[model samples]
Target: MKIVQISDTHLTAAGGPTEEGFRLLVRHLDEDVRPDLVVHSGDIQVLDPDDTADRVRSRELLDLISTPLLVVPGNHDVGMPGLNAWAGITVTDARVAAHVAVFGPDHWRHETDEAVLIGIDSELLGSGLQREADQWRWIEDTVADLPVRKPVLLFLHKPLWSATDEPVDHQVDVGPVARDRLLGLLERIDLRSVGCGHLHRYRQVRRDRAIEVWAPATAFLAAGEDSLPDGRQELGYVEYTVEGGEVTAQFRLVPGMPQITTDDVPSIAQAIEAMTALR
Candidate 1:
């Protein structure tokens, strides 16, 4: 199976260069990397978590892609726990339901002859909510039922960590509590790789038998000093192939997409004010 992973497109209803970047990505997918399935790791929209109109516009724009697509939420698409509240948005059940109402499910599973693809809402991991525990059970049960020989590819919105021992930054990656539980779960599963976005840069690391792939953002690059060591602050997506239960990944920079600095985007406060006005 051939899969393309696109993350952090951050397209907004108010059309701008961010939306143009996604348009370029779709064109590239059509003319070049035409894969069997597209897995959007997250951050499908820009700035607003509860904007149903943004979700509606995103759904319409993403529909331009003809390939089968699956998506999971990012902190931007749905509010993340212990985060975003300062901007006047907090993650609520209705907010998550809003995303599902527009984009299908916040998490899903798909099986191919050679591999199993699972997308989970990473925001739920450290939330300490009932849904978080429920998702863990679902993952464990689902993986337990699968054949031991089948490779499993997991997708989420944030990287596991910059390094295995990196300090926990709740905003950047999974926190300690979620990390410990998730790592324990992976130790028991036949995981081929874990793919994530949210950093805006690209970094890949290997943990025991599984590879962790971080696809670059299609919208912009991470600004100064924000990138992890040995990480590339580039603008692009990832393409991978699964054959004989083995997975190989390639980073394909979307040719000619204009690169924008983080300064070009609105601040959290500005975004919140803008979204409030929209409502």
Candidate 2:
């Protein structure tokens, strides 16, 4: 099966470069690379988790894709799970519910004749919410009930670990506690790959037996002080071809898609300002 993974669209109600970039991506998907399914690895909004209009606008833009779509929540969609959450907007029950109201469930599973696809809400990890516990149970139960030796492909918003050997940063990747728990649970299954997006860059890392694929943002590039440590800062998505319990990923970009930065757009800059002011 051919599956396309897109991440960090960051669509806003106020039309801008990010929106334009997504439009170009949609066109690219519809015309050039038609895949069996499309999965959004999240950050579906510009910055605010409380703004319903932004959520609606994101949904509208995502609806442009004609392929079947699955989405997971990003920090921007439902906030992070720590004291240093951006703009003091931490993940909460209400925020998660709001995201679920627009997009379906924050976590889900899709089964194909050849493989099992699981998408989880990485933002909920370490949040210490009842939902987090519930998700853990669901993950364990789901994996346990799967047929023996079924190849599992996992998807989430944040990377399980940082690209470098540095300690886990809650701001960029999953926390150590949650990561350990997840890794332990995943050991029981035949995990083929883990697909993620949040760094706004494209990268591929091999850990143990699984390949971790990070899809680039469909919106703007990370620049200046916000630049990521490693990976190609480009505008595109990830295309995965899976067959016979094996998968190969290729990064694809659309022609004429501008490689702009967050500072180049007024709407993004204003949104950053508003988020900072909240602190």
Candidate 3:
């Protein structure tokens, strides 16, 4: 089984083309590999409630994919305009439902040639949130004893923790306790790999227990200066090729594109600084 993952395309209504870079990658998949699934790991909306037309445009891109997907929302998709007013208007479930309407259900064990996929949405994992107890029950059931013929793989938008300094934009932030509860349950299952997004850059860490992660970003290679490519920012996706007890992962940039290698990435960052003249 082969799968492609794309994430964090902070798109807007103004530059409403096909998200040229995104289309390029999709085209390559359509013409060559043709993956069975393409899971988009959130941040689909551009963080504005008034951008209804743009949101609809974003969904248009979803319609172009021939493969099935498991999409979840990110903080940006939750309408980060006015914190107080956000509660009255934004419905994360409705946004997620739209994704499911295009992809698959909220969560499931998607039987693939290589593994059984377990999906969870951390966007709603908040304090004192027992209202979602039923959803948690469904996840526990889906991950229950499997056929033993497939290894288990988990997917989520925000990762369990941050391995770096960036707080607000990276890591799961306030989702630690909630995510731990979910992970503890998976510890009993026969798991192999876990994949995640939302950092906009790639970094992998192993828990020294049953699971290891493969973190890769599908968009935003914007490593201008601040985050050097060599040691800073890398924007790409992980191509997972699974075949009978063997899973190969590769962090390859979009075909024919030059990623922010150290010098270039830092230079780009410097350019941004120069534009702002904030020195």
Among all candidates shown, the one with the greatest TM-score: 2
TM for every model, in the order presented, reads: 0.90, 0.95, 0.74
Ranking according to TM-score, highest score first? 2, 1, 3
Clashes of 2: 0
Stretches of model 2 off by over 4 angstroms after superposition = 164-170, 224-228
Estimate, for each residue in 64-172, the C-alpha lDDT of model 2 and write its tens digit. Answer: 9999999999999999998888788899999999999999999999999888899999999989999999999999998888776888889999988665455433377
What is the per-residue lDDT of model 1 for residues 1-279, given as tens digits with 9 covering 90 to 100? 789999988777887777888988999998888899999999998867777777888889999998989999988887877753325455667778888888888878898888989889988877767777788899788767777777889999977754434444336776667777777776666788999998787777787777899889988776555335667778989999998878988888877888786567665336656665643
Per-candidate clashes, comma-separated: 0, 0, 6
Q: Poorest 10 consecutive residues of model 3 by lDDT?
A: 79-88
Global local distance difference test of model 3? 0.57
Q: After superposition, how far is residue 58 of candidate 3 from its true place, in Å?
A: 1.8
Q: Identify the leading candidate in terms of lDDT.
A: 2
Q: Please tell me which model should have the higher lDDT, number 1 or number 2.
A: 2
Candidate 2, residue 207: Cα displacement in angstroms equals: 1.4
lDDT, residue 10, candidate 2 = 92
Instruction: List, residue by residue over 119-167, the lDDT tens digit for candidate 3.
Output: 6665556512342565677777776666554677677666664434443
Give all candidates' CA lDDT scores.
Answer: 0.80, 0.88, 0.57
In angstroms, how far off is 25's CA in candidate 3?
Answer: 1.1
